[model samples]
Target chain A: MSLTNDRIKQRLIEKFGEPVSGFEELYGLLSFEAPKEMNLKILQFLFDDDELKFRFLTDLCAVNYPDDKGRELAVVYHLHNLVDNIRLRFKVFTNVQEPDVFTASKLFSSANWMERETYDFFGVNFIGHPNLKRILNVDEMDYFPLRKEYPLEDQTRIDKDDAMFGRGGTIV
Target chain B: MSEHQHHIKLPEGSIEKQTTTLNLGPTHPATHGVFQNILELDGERIVSSEQTVGYIHRAFEKLAERRPLYQITPITDRLNYCSSPLNNMGWHITCEKLLNIQTPKRVDYLRVIIMELARIADHLICNSIVGVDAGAFTGFVYVMEYRELIYEIYEEVCGSRLTTNIGRIGGFERNFSNTAFEKLEKFLREYPKVLKEFENLFTRNRIFMDRLVGTGAISAERALNYGFTGPNLRAAGVDYDVRVHAPYSSYQDFDFIVPVGNTGDNYDRFLVRNEEMWQSLSIIEQAYRKVQEFKGADAEVFHANVPEYYLPEKKEVYTKMEALIWHFKIIMGETAIPKGEVYNAVEGANGELGFYLISDGGRTPYRLHFRRPCFIYYQAYGELTKGAMLSDAIITMSSLNLIAGELDA
Candidate 1:
């Protein structure tokens, strides 16, 4: 029961109108790049299509395509269909200045944390996410740790002056 | 306004109270890691619990970028140290897929043997930690003792119990030691008895049930939605397992049951894991049989495409000049690894442990992402712990079986 890549591509194209430019299909993984504007609608199609009911939102993450000329930030979503057991991937290419994509947190509540994580590290903001706070980093942390611009070596020093774990930082 | 540690419950605050804050950890023993959780409490119940990670972040992903795929096995050691072999093997497999390396059948069997051992070791620790959190001190010690025995087998096989750099690009760096197999046979014989003891002690006990029943209950709908894998998702009645749902590392040949739970409660999750340990033992038994069955067969000979990545054999290096030069080249990691991206998910003891590696025609991977099970489970932590009692929080969190190493990594 090996699922070939061609089957997923044919189904996806038939469901959502022609994908944005630079859509490529690999072995068993499907990847398509959509402009930041059309991400919500394409996601809606994926959720609505009976054949490709990607009910299970497996993973929502972002990667910085720093060197890519046309766009800078690529927000990739690795979604899986629970009933069919096929995986589909869709990404949005947004510029570095305003890395905003509509939040799919309403569709999958788990997206709430992942979006916050993407925001914390890559500075990609989910437009309508209810609580978009830094997940991996502290509240006071100003920089996103996962971004390429951020220093590779963490500069936050552990303080030894407080009674409640440390001094400089209030236990939060 | 709470005063002393005793009766530390929140004062008469309204559910609508916006400013009431509750500090959960960093110093608290509940948070297993050197981690902190701050909660905005609303009268004895949590309004919001915000987790602050990077307290134990060691820049592992960044460190992987500096080394070749072979050398990065040690760094994977820290990601899931409880199941370092699983992490080590996962990294190697992903690199192999990118380089299109096919390992020998004997090596595949060897891989299964070690992975099953690591799985049992990891599950033992995870289940015992649940006991530790539940105040069953004696159970934790017993489980740890058995885990130490598993470590003994690991030590004999790879010379290190924690960070086992066993697999090369194409095959294992060396043959399995005879002493290790003998030790494993003895351990397998006794492990079931100890596991039965564990089930007798905690799985059916009323006190344990009180702490776990209905605590941290997540429905199948919610579990699947959050990318929850492994026991957490299975506990919610989802039969999906990476080994079965998506097989890798010759897992297709092996037969194992994907246990599912009904309620998604702490107890059900515990049941799933307990049964899972029993299942893991069976898997190891079968894996061992396969190892014995395929002893001298030349099942595979396809070397990984990145020739400069794998270390050459001792005989080859001593006799052949090209092999000697290749060994030196591999030492420097001056290999032209292809520009490819692959995502490999392994059914680790705790959950679905996946590695997303994007190599850019270089020796080292350009980007490496870990689809950690604990992280996914912890995302639902607030929903899991919201109205449950403080004791339930400890037990339920334990039942979720989230290792802090995997969570933070």
Candidate 2:
């Protein structure tokens, strides 16, 4: 039989136990979250496993949740098992203040730039990344732009009102 | 010798610096896009190269978080402008997937035709540009006419050309006009002959073959590890096409081959793209035939029946109350979006263009990340070009089809 979500979940539960939580299949994609420190360990397990040959690193990015205090940032990895034709999402949450997650670049070389991009946008500060500098944004940039704290529009602009724009008002 | 040394008293470290550091581009014509490669070279051979991108970083993902569903299509268009329709379609499909909207058969087939045309246009540019990089400009000049014909077909479907904001959230903004079908028919009747001629010009040409055959080759293993997808992966002999593996927009209904090459070199990439153009043509023909088989009312169906997201007719909006309210709600971005996360990918001209969208029942996405294939695989450029000749690096970059906008976005 082809690798199903239950089977993958079973394997992860077998290996990582209860720490691998929030298993849900939405829009046919199986998603689960793990502890921030176990990111590389899980990635390596997924790569080294015989049955779960999720070799292709489809995408890597970060999502910011300003309200989720202890876990303010989520680094999402989209891994594809080309042989079984299954895709899964693995996420690890970290606090914004110390957002240091182990890098996956050692396992997947493509993750080098992606991790850099994540660091640039969300300030993930991937630990042990070979060149963990900004990939897309300029180096002189101070704050992470994609974080929810940073609004898309300029705060200093006096002409436009945020209330009229329909997103809750910050306009004078 | 002592008198000559005294006459030209060189700096202490001048003779020890054996390699030259050359900046390939941020604006060089040969680089094709706004990308810079700082190459450490030993004479004409590259020692090690470092690439610096993000010249056109438009903060698209950040912008996407604020825009509603329909407004994001134009942002996708700028991702891979060479085949903007494909990007537009990919984004719309992502939205549709999140909303759980089912499209009609005619709309699916219509999408297939436009998307296949886009694939052909994209492959034409990459392959012909490969020829140009290899110093064969005639093929580029010849194939561009057909690309223009393809553009005319796009013009008939959508109003614009290059960065075409083509399709809507669920389907096309309008139906395919007769002129569009005629233009497609004209292209179909004429393009095969031109493609054959293009192939004849480059496939076996001694100079073109020599420049591309073995240079800049990446093994299938490395290509996958480096996240290579679409033609670049196919060129390395892995037939992992998004259209074939995960069929979308009625792609499973059509019959087409996923053409692959053996070596993963510049020549293989060129050949793979060229063969894919042929496959795209065949797929377009099948979709067109399937579209024609739709009888009566089915023929007129273009967009899906999702009034909540899709806009009503302008005349109806002006005349009727409900249409006006719906129109206003959609324009004002007040439509209720479902709370979910969905990832949708399409076989773009170069690679797999994926949209990872997360919506928290908000007007805009909670977080939206574009899995631009160019950006993912472009990290391999340093490895791909290491120890190769400077000119071959140019060929490899063009063969890789790295779009700067997509890369930096």
Candidate 3:
């Protein structure tokens, strides 16, 4: 039998009750959020459940939301159940000041580098990560580049004009 | 015996031997791209390995946040330059999904043709490079000529060779030229003989087989746990393909087989890619036939009627005021976008190339994350190459086909 989003939602709700919220089906993808602490438990449940065998960790990344107080960094996990060929997204948000979420490297080996990348870019401290330092970026770099706090373009570049690039220009 | 007697007696197995630390590359010729691998070697065998990427990190995601939707296509081009049309099409499809633009069947067929050609080009490079790495230089040069032919087809279609920013969100920027079809036909005819010859050169060759057959084998379970996809996972014996599982761009209409291999070794990866090239050729042929069958208005239509997003033609832009205004608006990203988050995946030459897009009803994306397959799969290199011979490790890296641009992006 093919796994439907509704069944998965019901299972998640039954297992973790109030902790799991924001159940949404955006463009046919089931997405929801849980408390940062329950990330491992929810992932384990999703993996261990016979009906919801989302064993494949399709993607793991963190998105920084600077404006959202106490929920500044969202670590998103895209999981796929190969048997049913279905995919669902699980997300957990944490405060930017104390962005500590348990790692899922033990559950999915793919998470090791991905978590390191998450740490490298968004500075989401993945607690329990065996070798969490930096994956893609240089170790000498101090700040997280992906966080909304940094400007997209190099602020120091004087050669390029902002008006020419359509940044400050008004469309005629 | 006199010298040994002079020294203190040592306990059995207590003598320490230092493993040589060899740095393979961030610029070595054998690496094919800029990636560093520090290997601890016990003679010719690798004891442990550590991979370092980000030599070409351009912060594409960060760049995407600042650029308008249409302008981001060029950034996608740099991700996998070997099969850039696939990346372009993937980004376009993601944008189309976000905007809820339904492309026509003819457009879908056109996309499939371009994507398959890109797949062929990508696989040709990967397979031939594996040959090159395995000391069969002739096969690499032979397949490269065919890759140039594929590039000609791309050039004819998009006016660019390597990093082809091919299509628009709604559909193609323009209609496929007659010369493009001619080039495609020429490629379709000539590539097969070259591919067959190339395969014959390496497939049964005892040296190539011996080097690759048992080298860098990853179990299916470990591959899945490590989020392997496309040919690598398929080579590991799992029959999961994004095209078959989740049909996009008229992939469902066509008939093709997803090839699988047993051991997920370098040889299996080579074989799986070779078979996929054949499948991609068939798919393009079928798509081309379907495209030819379209009559009258359906035949002439290329880009969809979404003027707000799709730029107007050059002639129309010069002649009409509204056309000029709409073109400027689209280019400037003045058009309002829907507030939503959408995840779209296309079967890139490597694997499931996915884009997670979030829009806040603004011209620019709120956040965009690209699920680059190479970046995900390259994580297992340390595990795969551990305890393997140094020569075998080189072949393993080549077989994985890790493009540094995609890896670091």
Candidate 4:
């Protein structure tokens, strides 16, 4: 029998209790959230469980939520089970001021560069990462560019026409 | 060496062996694209290495946040520039999923043809470059000529060649021209013979085999742990293909084999890619035949019936006021997108090219993240090349087919 999202959710809830919450089914894929501290434990459980063997780490990325106050950064993990051909998304949000989530690099080696990339973009510092420095951005860059706090466009550029870009401006 | 011997005149216990640090290009031909690897070498064998990417980092994900759904297709072209149509289609599919647009059967079959052609084009470059890295230049030149043929097909379909933003959100920007079909037919007839010849040149060559057979081999466990996908994972003996598993873009309609290899080495990657090109050819032929079965209006139905999202016809835009208004609105990013989050992945030539799109009923995406296969696979470079010769490392990298544009995006 193939694994279902309900069974997986029940297992997670039974194991971690109240820490695991926000179970959602989006586009037929199972997605849920857990406390930031229990990420490694949840990942370990998902990998070690016989029925729920989400062994393949499909992707690791972070989403910044500047308006969420305490929970401002979300570290998302897309895991896949090769046996049943099932995919699950697990996310853990952290405070932007103290974004310290445990690294999953020990369990999934793919998380090494991904964690570094998350740090490079959203400034989510992964605790216990061997090399947690910037992976994509330059080392000298001080600010995390992907954070909502930063502007999407270059603020210093002055020789530009807003009207050409569909913004309201007097024609030449 | 004499100077070191004079300076270290103490006992053997007191002397420390120093390994040479070699920088293998952010711009070297052997490295393919702009990727720098600082290799710690003990003679020819590599001790340790650090890869520095992002020389071509354009912050695509950040840029996607600002651009509207339609405008982002061109940006997707720059990523995996070899098989840009796949990226373009992948982005369009994500938008379609968000907007709940159902494409026609003809559109799906048409997409399959273009996507498979792009896959073949990408694999040709990768496999040919592997030959080039192994000091076999003839295969590279021979296969590259066919890549130009594929580009001509792209030009016929769309106006551009390399960065082909071929299709629209609902379907193609325009219907396939007669020249396009002729070029595709010519390619189908001629490419197999050229590919066979190219394979014969390197498949049994002793020098090429020796250089690649056991070099940079990664175990399936290690590969999966590193989040490997597409050919790299298949080369490791895992039969997890997105097209087979997920079946996007009507891939399930056509039947094809997923080629896998025992050892995930440079040679296995080469073999897997070669077989995949053949499979892609078969898929394209099937899809093309299916597309030909359509008659009259059914054949002409390329784009879906979502007039709000799809641009109006040029003639209609010139003649009708409603057509002109719809065209203007669609081009100006005035079309309303549904508020939802969808993650759509396509089996790109490299791996699973995924677009994680979140929309909040805005003209632009709330957040867009591209799951680039090159970036994911390039992470395992240090593990793959460790304890291997410097020359072997070059071959391993080439076999991985790490496109810097995709890597640093």
For this target, which candidate reaches the highest DockQ against the unseen true structure?
Answer: 2
**Clashes per model (N, Cα, C within 3 A):** 2, 0, 0, 0
Best by TM-score: 2
Superior candidate under DockQ, 1 versus 2: 2
Candidate 1: list runs displaced more than 4 Å. Answer: A1-7, A138-145, A149-172, B1-21, B40-48, B296-307, B313-320
Model 1 lDDT vs. the true structure? 0.74
A-chain TM-score of every model: 0.79, 0.92, 0.90, 0.89
Task: Point out the higher-scoring one by TM-score: 1 or 3.
Answer: 3
RMSD of 2: 2.1
Q: What share of the true interface contacts does each candidate keep?
A: 0.41, 0.71, 0.68, 0.63
Residues A7-115 of candidate 1 have per-residue lDDT tens digits of 6567666755565546676546777777788887777777887666777766677777776855778888888776767787787888888777899898887788778
Place model 3 in a CAPRI quality band: medium
Candidate 4 displacement at residue A89 in angstroms: 1.3
For B1-409, candidate 1 gives per-residue lDDT tens digits of: 4455566555566544675677777757776665566776656666667666656766566566656677888877877788888888887887777777777666666787788788878777777788788888777877787788888877886678777765677766656677878888988888888888888899878887877787789999888777788888898999988787777777887878888998998888878888888777887888778777753544333233345667887899999998999987777666656888777778877777778777766666766777777777687887888876666776766677766677666
Residue-wise C-alpha lDDT for candidate 2, range B75-158, written one tens digit per residue: 999999999999998988888899999989888999999999999999999999999988889999999999999999999988
**Tens digits of per-residue lDDT for model 3, B230-295:** 999999999999999999998999999999999999999999999999999999999999999999
Q: Given candidate 2, what's the lDDT at residue B384?
A: 92
lDDT of 3 at B139: 93
